[model samples]
Target: MSNKTIKIGQLDMELQSIFSAFEHHVHTAVDTAAEKTAEEAVKKLKKTSPKNKRAKRGKKYKNGWKYKKTSEGMTVYNEQYQLTHLLENGHDIIINGEVRGHAAAHEHIAPVEAWAQDEFPEEFKRQVGKG
Candidate 1:
């Protein structure tokens, strides 16, 4: 990347390569930031995830939180997939296929999501600075 003053044959190619490299650098930084933020969210979710002692379940949902990288980006999921939405948003108490009542929503995901939303930018900045 010179001054781009006088006419140069390789100037265009050089500029393209430079820009592409910078783009790649930024993309890597973003991905790093996304992963860190996602990990933080997963940890927070695990800590805050509810443990229903009364239910004769195998274990607490606390340990099931995990994050994965998708084509779109990072995705946080519970290994206990069947209970995630039900626990987060509350569910209808069904008895033999009949809705009897509603379970109270014990919000464990939303707060972490909000924190991630606020944390990603800072994490991106930190990653880029390190780069």
Candidate 2:
């Protein structure tokens, strides 16, 4: 008899099933870790010196602003999910939106000048810094 053998039984199918199960488990673990890290960062930011909860408000729009269309002709309104905070330095920071625990969340503050500049360029200039 030849030394080579082919298994036409359940073993081949079971091996493939085991690998697929492992792949799913790893994917879940990685996703959970990333989400938890982001949540922790938000928690830390909220716990800084002020130690007071902020109130919710509507999006602050600039005066005389008109809606413009994107290249694809989608009307671009300054629709953003944002949280606004006043800092000791008299500047504003508006954070981009995120889904937190099945609800939309936006956390922003005045001290985060760099993030405000980079993330919300148009709003930052008009609202916070020199326009």
Candidate 3:
């Protein structure tokens, strides 16, 4: 019996191509998932944000909510003013060196955290397929 040898160069090339495609797929999937999650978080924050009663009668905190994609992940933020931190965390309202009262925390980030916890893993799994 004669033994035959086979070259796997073509097979290797095919595998490399498949892997490249898979990598691109993963990147796209992650980006899409992150974008969707960020948008959802913004929506949730807008809906739940406490309205500024002191502002113009029909003014809404919802209008402040915005989102953008970041290198590490996604970011949801408020654009109305730099008051998101103050609104999310209770702060003392001081007047003329007098402490008036504490503003209650609205906690916009908490909902985003909760949403990411529920969404990210599921989205990754669905996009990339089971590891």
TM-score of each: 0.82, 0.33, 0.82
Q: Which of candidates 2 and 3 reaches a greater TM-score? A: 3
List candidate 1 segments past 4 Å from native: 1-7, 55-58, 96-101
The candidates, ranked best first by TM-score, are 3, 1, 2
Best by lDDT: 1
| Superposition TM-score, candidate 3 onto the true structure | 0.82
Q: Tens digits of per-residue lDDT for model 1 on 1-131? A: 46556458877887888889889989999999999999999889988888888877735577888899999999998888999889999999999999999999999888999999999999998988885
**How much is 92 displaced in model 1, in angstroms?**
3.7
Candidate 1 shows a clash count of 0
Residue 56 in candidate 2, Cα distance off native in Å: 12
With a 3 Å backbone cut-off (N, CA, C), the pairs that clash in candidate 1 are none
**Candidate 2 per-residue lDDT over residues 1-131, each given as its tens digit:** 24545577966886788788767765555444433433333343444323224434311321111233345321222222121222222333344654333322233333333432343434323432221
Which candidate, 1 or 2, has the higher TM-score? Answer: 1
Per-candidate total of colliding backbone pairs: 0, 0, 0
lDDT of each: 0.89, 0.37, 0.77
Residue pairs whose backbone atoms clash in candidate 3: none
